[model samples]
Target: MIESWRWYGPFDKITLPEIAQTGATGIVTALHEIPYGEVWPSALVASRNGEIRAAGFDWVVVESLPIHERIKRGEGDLSELFANYRQSMANLAANGVKTICYNFMPLLDWTRTDLTAPVARGGSCLRFEAAKMAAFEIHMLGRAEAEADYTPEALQMAAIWFQKASETDRDALLHAIMSGLPGAFDRYDIAGLRQALKGYEGIGRADLRANYQRFLDEVVPAAEDLGMALCVHPDDPPRDILGLPRIVSSGADITWVLNAVDSPANGLTFCTGSLGANPTNDLPALARQFADRVHFAHLRNVRKDPDGSFEEAAHLEGDTDMAAVIAALLDEQKRTGRIIPFRPDHGHELLWDAEKGTHPGYPLIGRLRGLAELRGVIAGLRHRD
Candidate 1:
């Protein structure tokens, strides 16, 4: 595995020089300044790649090249969106960046109920609690039929949780969940959110699966022709949220998507933190099963509770068998003789980053610690492999 770090382009708080010092030789980033469904002019792609090389780093992967909502829902002007997405892929490939990571989660990206859940080590990590999420969807967002998804006990717990939360707390949670999209901020008002949810009111899991299949059918060939690999990121928290259907949450989902196109260009971004959120997912086994198709990796862990609450645990300290997962990856590398570029997916805000403000789960020192831990794991396991 080639060590990489996700840098949010020039606007990120952590500078390239600082990232270069972290012992990562590759960068996972995107042209975030360009809006969704817009052409990424080759000139801009070249310029960004040049910047990364100038900073002594290689552009390993585009952590995301946003998939337009129109494309996801198979609505609006999909032809235009697909053209733009394909052009972006070609431009990225032309610039020598091949691997691309994207997701199809409706309306929101990866979400969490708390951005600063305290860890035993006196640091903070991101958390997603089902009860708290239900509280937000029911009492706060007032989404129709939101209570139908939770159990009776969970519903009662949500009522109590919502009752105890103050307005300030509610706002904080809302901001944490609603904001943080690449190149976007806390501009998602209630009306806008509700309106967005309305678009998916009748769409269920089956419909989402079909749409995603169509997405693969339309884009995978272009990716293959361009000699670029497209990796679809798993749903964060790996479950349904906001009354929206989630399709890419399990091994079945992965198998479905990969079979849809049946090409190496159509691949998976094996994200442990996302897939590990669901306790049923066997990380190492899945890693091995999908080894041939995994183009990129996000190595992190989450401590999951039976009730669907989870917190981002330290890289090697969580429920995931980091050693087994890494060993599987190393085995795949050895078998195929292909390098998989992976990064410390998300980290707790620890050390110097604990004292300062930074992107949630993206604090510098926290990720540095994660990388170091992962490096040690790889070194120890690679020898045995």
Candidate 2:
């Protein structure tokens, strides 16, 4: 495994020099400033890659080339956007970059109810609390049909939770889901968000799945031609949330998706955190099954419930069997002779990190702990050879 870290580009509080100190050798990043659907020019790709290399890191993977709303809806300018995405793939390939990771979740990228849940580490971690989400949907965003999505008992519980929330709590809730927050696919005000959803109003899971198939058919060929890997990231919270459709949440979902295009260029991101958000997803098992197609990985564990509540657990201790997952990944690497780019995903906010303003759970020491633990696991597995 090639150790890497996700950097949100230049403005990120964690600098490349800081990342170097963590002993990471690669950077997982994308051009966030370039809005969705715009072609990433060869110059921009080269420039970004150059900067990372200059900072003593290999530009190993593109965390995403976001699938535009237009493409998802198959609506206005979608064909043009699809072509642009193809062009972006070619540009990245032109700069000798491969392993592009993207996701297909609707209206949101990834979501969590709390970015600062208390954890044992004397700091905080990002958490996805189902009740808090219900709290947001029903009492906060006031979604029209939100009350229907949950059980009557759940709503009753949420009403009590809502009663304790003050104006500050509401603002935090709004910010947690919006304001360029980590889990949300993208941030928009209530009105703008509704408008975004309006665009996908008629599009359901079937339409989205069909669109994904159509997209892979069109873009995977481009990727293969350009010698690039197209890695599709799994849905975060991996199930239906806020009444939106979720297509990439299970093994069957992955199998169906891979079969949709049936090309080596089409691949998976292997995000354990996203998949582990659901207790049912067997990470180690899936690793072997999808080994060859996994282009990048986000390895983190979650403490989850069937009710959809989950908190980030210590890298080595959550519901995910990290040791087994690591072993499977290493075995696959040895068999395939491919170095997979793996990152620790979200680290809990702790120690010196809590005092400083940094992206939540991106603290260096915590991730260093995660990376070292994972490295030890790999070493143990390799030594058993």
Candidate 3:
């Protein structure tokens, strides 16, 4: 496996030089400045690659080249959007960045109800509490159909939570959920959110899945022709939220997606933290089953509660059997002779990270500790072999 780190371009407080010092030779990043639906020019791609190389790292993977909202919803001017996406892939491939990770989640990206949930040992981790999310959706967002999505017991819990929540608590919840959108803090208000949801009024699971399949059909061949692999990220919670359907959440969903296109270029970004949120997903078993099609990995873990909430756990401390998953990935690498690039994802905020204003869940020292621990695991496993 190739150890990698995700760097959010030039503005990221953790500079490329700092990333190099973490012992990772591969950098997973994206052209975040490039707006959605715009083509990435070859010169700009080359420039970013040059920057990474100058910092003594290779830009091996694009954490995302975002799929435009119009593309996801099968809205107007799709042909132009598809053309732009293909051009971006070609530009990325021209610059020797062949692996691309993206998601098709509607309206928002990965979400959480608390960005600073305190953990043991004097640190903080990202958390998603079901009740809090339900409260936001039912009481704050006031989505008419939100109640239908939750169990009666869950609805009762949400009602109680919302009834007791102060103005500050409600505001924080809104911020946490909205923070998942790219630049949404400044760009989106409740009206914007409602309008976004309105666009999907008639769309359901089947409609969204068809739209995703259309996207795959159009782009998978282009990716193959460009010598690139396109990996779709799993939904963050592996479940529907805000009444929007999540098609890439379970093993069955993964199977449906891979079968939808049936091409090597179409692949999965195996995200442990996302899939592991669902108790039924056997991480090690799924890793083994999909090893051949897993083009990238997000190596993180989460602790699930009985009440359907979850928190990011230490890389190796959660329900996931990290050693077993790594062993499977190692075996796959040996079998296929391809090094899988993986990064330590969503590390807790520890030490000076809280003061550094680092991106949520991406603190320096926390991820360094995670990488060191993961490296040790790989070494020990190889010794046993």
Error of 2 at 213 (Å): 1.0
TM accuracy, model 2: 0.96
lDDT of 1 at 78: 81
For residue 372, give model 3's deviation from the true position in Å: 1.1
What is the number of backbone collisions in each predicted candidate, taken in the order shown?
0, 3, 0
Query: Global lDDT of each model?
Result: 0.88, 0.83, 0.89
Worst 10 residues of 2 by lDDT: 177-186
lDDT by residue (1-385, candidate 1, tens digit) is: 8999999886678999999899999999988888788999999999999999999999999978888777767786688888888888988998899999999998788898898889996888999888888888899889858888777777889999989999898888888787447665325866788888787868888888888888888899999899999999999868888888888999998998999899999999999999999888999999999999999999999998878889999999999998888888899999999999999977888768965566677899989999999999999887775
* lDDT digits (tens) for residues 18-131 of candidate 2: 889988899988888777878998998999999999999998998788888777777765778889999988888888788899988887877877888888748788887777
lDDT tens string, model 3, 29-135?
A: 88888888889999999999999999999998897888888877888769989999999999899889999999999878889999999988888999998888878
Q: What would the TM-scores of all predictions be?
A: 0.97, 0.96, 0.97
lDDT accuracy of residue 123 in candidate 3: 89
Ranking by TM-score: 1, 3, 2
- Tell me the TM-score of model 3: 0.97
